[model samples]
Target: MKAGREELMEIIDLWGYSEDAQARIREILESEDVPPPHLFRYYGDRPGKVEQAERLFERTIGTPHALAVNSGTSALMAAIAAAGIGPGDEVLVPGYTFFASASVVVASRAIPVIVEVDETLNMDPEDMARRITPQTRAAVIVHMKGNPADMDPLMRVAADHDLTVIEDVAQACGGSYHGKRLGTIGDFGCFSFDFYKIAQSGEGGFVATADDYLYMRAQSWHDTAACWRPDRYAEERREGELFCGENYRMSEMQGAVALAQIRKLDGYIGALRANKKRIRDQIEERDGLALRRQPDPEGDASTSLVMFADSRELAEEMMAAMRERGVGVGGRFDQTVRDWHVYSYWEHILEQKTVTDEGCPFTCPYYEGQLPDYGPEMCPNTLDLLSRSMHMGISDTWSPEECDRIAEAINSAVSEVLG
Candidate 1:
């Protein structure tokens, strides 16, 4: 007998792995010939491996420098610190993003000014322009869920205001914007390799930049109290002094896994894109369910596929139904930083200091006063779309058949729940 819809759904996990992955992982684990060391030891003396890793990164990104760090958050923090953005400085970040985007700014001792997002769920350049003032030192454009932010206009605006642009390319490892890789476009680009990411190393990240000074600073920050000497990092070390930051370096084991994953990035990206297209084609006809639109077709490269709901109620209902049928879905950035209670405590600190609207430094009420009245109208498109959006993971492991099954199940569930 044929299985029921629920049965089929239960059998189809979104992230299906190839047999080769298991073999590769096992081969690495069983090897005993001077077994690969963890990152701590690997980075201690195996300078040649680090050089190989850097070469791989350089070839893949075509960037002048790539500083592998512990996490995407560290990359952002180090990059912000290296760029000279500090206390009293305001960095514009999109409201609809992972908390890290804003957290990094706060961690850097700078204030995070929340900006609205456009249809693509990226930072809205118009809102960004309105929020920018004399104190706005930089902007972190988070390519939310692997979709590239509108970089062309964003870059133009940054140039006009003399502001630095940092591309939070953590979610967009293989993504590009206007023929340029996502991380390479901005003043500095950050990438993550957490297990859930497209190009994962179990836990790691990297920062890419063309600026010699910023690159050198990032290296020092990754290695506590360590300065890059020509004899030490020769062809690898780009620039910077001995101002040691925190230790956020990635290990060689993680780097090895990352190197393996990087080799398969293009193929993985192709499979994800193809699967996304199939799923979207099947579900776009359903009512009360909408696919997230990409501004640039070529720029959306990661595997975390997002969709829009007609309303918050509908979105919650759809998510419940999908989960009931064994399909996983997630919400977009619902807890905005401005609404988080932690910011309130920080408010007191800003209150003790002088805040001037002349430049409109930060988003805190103490700085901006009562916060800009952000409602549905201020960002009609994002507000409307977010109320009902949902996301699904598109892993390299899923087959075309599995993707089709997922799409059909989602469509049927939406029809049954909403209709």
Candidate 2:
């Protein structure tokens, strides 16, 4: 049955931080010193925060080196730079993802060759293999909406092509594949602690790498010109200054909050998974709405829950009806990277300065084209899925009863619209 307006209102009301969360924030606020450490403050006196962030990264990610950055996007850009992706180099990314996944490639003056995603809404190994060429230097596999991409096949393909695999774990903070954590699988894993993520430090990100050379390279790019002590670097450090990049360091306050949040991640992920299962049971019987299911692959870890409709219009209508009824839902990736005007028309302003793979013959020719016709049939599944997906915020804050209410609202909205 459709949820009443009151129930919908109650669901929407549950979207904000809980009283307990607010109390924790207040505690943090009261305990902090004046002027709070500058977010990118890397000066003489403020060097201690960087050490705090480094310690936090080591403890949380279980990696030797972690470079705190201002945003997940910057972390991705730095990772690409550290991997040595440059102009004329083609980096394979999913067609159905946030623009940052591809835009970072463009920002590095590299070509982002769009690849089709699987039913999991992650980069498809088959499509990734098809997209690879002599010019392909790396691939950024996004764990879209917190779902772990099929990593074994992806890793195999990357190995075959001699490409560096950079895992975009922005949405899958506490998620793991098989026995290993999501961020630790690839050459480098980038994570986001944005407000909407499972853990939030307001806004911040960190990058993890197992490679000693790449780790130090990423560290320098994150904070160039600063004298970084060798002991701080987990990986083997190069003696000379190789390349210089912009400062993308995170704040001490953000690091402090993130440390606290990291302590709660396992419990939070458990709650979210349980909530998702409850909602899934309630809505599985509906005809018009279909939830994205985790494939039973060799090493798959179920993460966030997402639902899909038949078309964008249907998805939009359902979202609108749910919102009108006071439920807060969102479209997964309705607007694809190709649909963005920035990539299509304003390419000149956003173009990067350095080009790494300048002599590669098979680099993308239509890099500046509004929409390069990779053929209508190239990514049929992703195009179809993108036109029809809707997502619910499966946060730990959502109670089991709240999940039921959301399921009821979705079922009601779909029945009313389709029947």
Best by lDDT: 1
Q: Could you report the Cα RMSD, in angstroms, for every candidate shown?
A: 9.7, 9.6
Q: What would the TM-score be for candidate 2 when compared with the true structure? A: 0.74
Error of 1 at 161 (Å): 1.3
Pairs of colliding residues, candidate 1: 16-397, 39-251, 39-252, 309-388
lDDT of 1: 0.73
Error of 2 at 315 (Å): 4.3
RMSD of 1: 9.7
List the lowest-lDDT window of 10 residues for candidate 1: 340-349
Instruction: Give the residue spans of candidate 1 off by over 4 A.
Output: 1-47, 231-240, 285-288, 320-326, 333-384, 415-419
Q: For model 1, how does the per-residue alpha-carbon lDDT over 1-419 read when each residue is reduced to its tens digit?
A: 43333332332322354557655644664563353333452435655444566668777878999888878988898899889887667788787666677778766767777777877878888889988877788999988777888898998889999998999988888888778888998899988888878888778888999998888777777777463455554444444556658988676656767778888887888888888777877885556666776777766785767777778878888888888887888765354434321223233233423245433334444443233443324445555566567878877678899988898889877887778
lDDT by residue (70-134, candidate 2, tens digit) is 78998899899888777567788887666788778777877677788877888889989987877
